[model samples]
Target: MLSWVQKRGTSEHRTGLETPLQGPKQRCWFVWDPMGIIFAIATWALVLSGAWVLVRDLLIPSNNVFYAIANGVVFHLLASLALVSHLRTMLTDPGSVPLGNPPGPDTVSYCPFCLCAIPERVYHCTVCRRCIRKNDHHCPWVNNCVGEDNQKYFLLFTLYVGLMSTHVLLLLAIPVLRSHARGEWNASSTVSLPGPIFFLFLVALMGFIFALVMLCSQMCSIYKDKTTTEMLHQNKHSQGRQSMWANIKAICGPRVSLAWLSPFHSPDRYKVSERHVMA
Candidate 1:
């Protein structure tokens, strides 16, 4: 672990590098957590199912099933793209670099990994294998450090994923209701085992439900202008309160929407208020 520390009576500071941190076991990569694997599989399943529905509709000419499938696919694609883009931005944003120096007094240089001057509230992530800007803890799900640049995207990803999940749930529920209303299944009808299609729908339903709940909770925390890490840290420190609403407004300013459409934005375009720093 690496850390930045400041001298008590002087402006001079230093960065400290500890023992090397290794990544998760190789098996972890291959057998990703069951939840993650399920989520990934469900995501791909939805995409393939959507495609099948579309192709089937084209071939049959009158099947509405394809239309429903197309809707689900589009919703998933947009949400997934938005979420991924946001995650990418968070992982690569340099600004997230925290504000001091490495551990040794004579070390004139900063850690290339973190890219921050280094001070309090900063730390290195073993997962990212780099010093983080304004270092927050590493998120295993994201497989990256959430620093200054990517914070906004991370928030956006959570928000959009929740919305997307809710949308998918609704979309799937609608067709299911219709099918039941038509009395397509009766006691006399043989109960076929749930196939890939049924399982895909089930997975999507469950994934979105879970994602939506988590996203909503995170959004509430973000709306208050705090990270999960920050919130937890606050419990142990005497830091002042942050105005989350104000931070949100600042990030979502006039040009904020542009973030969704494009990945490369001038840092200058995103104005950081003193209030944002306080948070």
Candidate 2:
């Protein structure tokens, strides 16, 4: 969930309009916002297109052991995981604070604009038009808020997508570079890769760089047990009392040992609550 240039106070472009208060209602929080939707569409279109081309080219890689792993396992599993996590992050609601009256004294504050209870670590998202649980950032790529509910999916998506892109680039890089330098692909080669393959490789490399940066930033936030929002607004932020491992488990789930490393294996994953955290 990378929001590099997010205007923190800007109201949602379209959904910012406060719907007429019904007998008890004040505003709409479930309506769609077009700014994020458009960015998500364009970003995912490029991602899917590049992934397709990479997978197509790597279907039957060289008989060498390294290439075999790259083609058979890494390409299929990582790409699939990347796709799933991406979709999950995009579709999953990053958890909105319950509307209306405050549930309990635990709520740290109240949002005047939305007239909703604001809990600890949660903040109002102007774009989402709601207070998000453990609010992190609004990611235009996923067109969703990255908060307590979907942070894990967002992280996994970033890591897997970055790895997959790098893998594709590595696999095709030699051929692309050699061909470019020599001015022609080797005619005698058993597999004749398209010229566009080089361009695709370059594209994947760029994606890798972008994802890597996001991954590192997310990891740093996790290590500090802070959300991007909290980090950005340090003066106004207060964090939960959780250790580093507790922070990781909160996001990666109980099956992090297995699920973090593989997409095909979902070995009884479950979310940890605030009670599970250590001081």
Candidate 3:
């Protein structure tokens, strides 16, 4: 709800944001933001590295047009989706607390720093320097606070990345099998695979394992209608399926199936207002 205002008598709109002198709910940034840069560099490095290996060894050299094209299509598609989602998550406003608004009947609390009505599930992120609606943990890798507005994007990014890693691993298997069948590959020769081939296999495996663990953890939190922050403190609930699904719809939007692959908004999503249970 907090929108930036322009400086009076100036044609330029105020650019840099400053946290007001509110309580702990607001904080002035003291250091440079390094997360976004690190995340972007790491993401592209892995993706490009994997693509080079796959196309050079498996996709192109295989001389199978259909296989190459199909794998290329799927791989690049996932990478694009993942990259786009990551950007969306990083750049999006993570549901700010409405400033100077009186609390409604259901809103009984206030953010100490922002002095805004506190709805259920909203919390303050010191790193982000604001109170976020339905606040999830501030993810360093994405370089953003995961909140109601961008949680879906965060999850979709994770899903696509995990799939990308797994798919690359599958692609790596072909050459590995051939080498093994011909008795040309041995444990000692693990170091002898082409540089790209070895790098792709190792990176893919590590990526898949890391993403799988993170994905499973996130899924559990979503299923229970809880965030990792809440889960860390042992938050538990016995909400009905409908309630849980409502949380899903909140994050995944209405068209759950299409939502994962695309960034289009569905009609049903508009009807849903922002809401979150306090941690």
Best by TM-score: 3
TM-score of each: 0.59, 0.71, 0.74
TM-score of 2: 0.71
**Tens digit of lDDT per residue, candidate 3, span 136-211?**
6887777778876777777877888899988988777766788789999767775457777888888888778867
Candidate that beats the other on TM-score, 1 or 2, i.e. the better one: 2
- Report lDDT (Cα) of residue 74, candidate 3: 95
Q: Which stretches of candidate 1 lie over 4 Å from their true place?
A: 1-5, 12-62, 65-73, 76-80, 83-87, 94-117, 133-137, 182-194, 233-242, 250-279
**Ten consecutive residues with minimal summed lDDT in candidate 1?**
19-28
Better of 1 and 2 by lDDT: 2
Task: State the lDDT of candidate 2 residue by residue for 63-134, as single tens digits.
Answer: 466666557576777777887887778776676665653323344456766675444676888888877777
Reference-based TM-score, model 3: 0.74
* Alpha-carbon deviation at 273 in model 3, angstroms: 7.5
Instruction: Summarize candidate 1's per-residue lDDT along 178-204 as a digit string, tens digits.
Output: 877999867786644246445545645
Least accurate stretch of 10 residues (summed lDDT) in model 2? 1-10
Local distance difference test scores for all models: 0.47, 0.66, 0.67
